[model samples]
Target: MKWLKKSVLLIAVFAVGVVSGSMIWTSSANNTGLVDPNRPGSVNDPLITKSYVDQAVAGQVKTELEKQLQGQLEQLDKMLADKQKEMDDKIVQFQKQLDALISKAGGMTVVELQPNQTMYADPGATFIVRNGTTIAVSTDANGIPDVTGGKDLMDGTPIELNHMLIFPREGRGIKSTHSSTVFVMVTGGYTVMNPDGTIAASSSMDNSDQNETAE
Candidate 1:
């Protein structure tokens, strides 16, 4: 009976150890389910769905397309600005050339005269006498004198006279010294200059005419 009781106690202890080891093994298997390939809902399972992959790929492609579009737009803006500047430059150059042409077309001509020299004047021309020299003149578009380096002459301003008229000296009245009267062509009509340098107009002078003057 004692041997039988010892044997029964050892059998009970072995059965308890087997039950405890079986419980520990079950806990370890439950913990390892997250990393196991054979278990469902584990780390090795495919987590990336088709919808998620498609969305990621679409987002990357959209970003690349947006970047390329922005680059093209920037390049187009630069090209337009450069073309506008080039057109503006061409317009400015054309304007300068046009202005030069107009200026040249509207310019005037001048002729210098010496003492006792006679020159035929145009119908719209003027005669200016200054500093022992005479000048035939015309006006520009601005009605300004067209003589070279000359300005509008004003009396009593201490300014140099660009145009003058003949005035006899004191006690020397003009008298005829030639056999025939000398003719001086003026703007509107012919002027008769006596041998003694006296001047007479062929017709009545008009004050409204720029080229017509009375001295």
Candidate 2:
């Protein structure tokens, strides 16, 4: 009888433990299911939201586009500067060439004469005679000489002798009997002779015509 009672008591205790364990497990599972769905580590939790991902992608794309546009603008600016410099250089070269052509066509030639040096002039040419820092005579188209424009000779200004003393067709060409400086302008070449009548120098005349001045 004593053994039978003990066994029944042990079986009863074991059944009670099983029932309590089952109830505790059921309650825990129910509480786990009721937890906030949006909490971290939950099934419905979002690692990265849709809106955030979209904004990030848009920002990245905008940055890239801006960089590309800046690069293109820089390239264009460089090209324009290079072209402008090339054009400026070409213009300068062209002006130089034009000036050279004009000088060869019709330019003035200055001649310095020693004392008693005679310069023969052409029949229809003109000359400017200066004696010791003074324009003694300026000849006209008719071989007439005068000192009309000599009073306005400013210091450091080039003395322009448009027309001056003329030499006769056959006489002692500008005898220069006295010491004098002579400037001669003619359509053809002329001969400069020393007092001994020997040719000292000869030169051809060029026209002084300029359309525009270079910068």
Residues 118-202, candidate 2: write the lDDT tens digits.
Answer: 5555554445443333222223333333335533322222333343443344322343443444334333345566767666665
TM-score of each: 0.34, 0.32
Residue-pair clashes per prediction, in order, are: 1, 5
lDDT string for model 1 (1-215, tens) is: 99999999999999999999999887887788633664555566756688999999999999999999999999999999999999977975674465445436644222222234333333344433222322232222222233444554222122123332222111111122223221221222233332245433223434344134223
C-alpha lDDT of all candidate models, in order: 0.44, 0.54
Residue-level lDDT for 7 in candidate 1: 100
Please give the lDDT score for candidate 2: 0.54
In terms of TM-score, the best-performing candidate is: 1
The worst-scoring run of ten residues by lDDT in candidate 2 lies at 206-215
- Model 2: per-residue Cα lDDT at residue 150: 32
Once model 1 is optimally superposed onto the true structure by TM-score, how far is the C-alpha of residue 208 displaced, in angstroms? 34
Which number leads on lDDT? Answer: 2
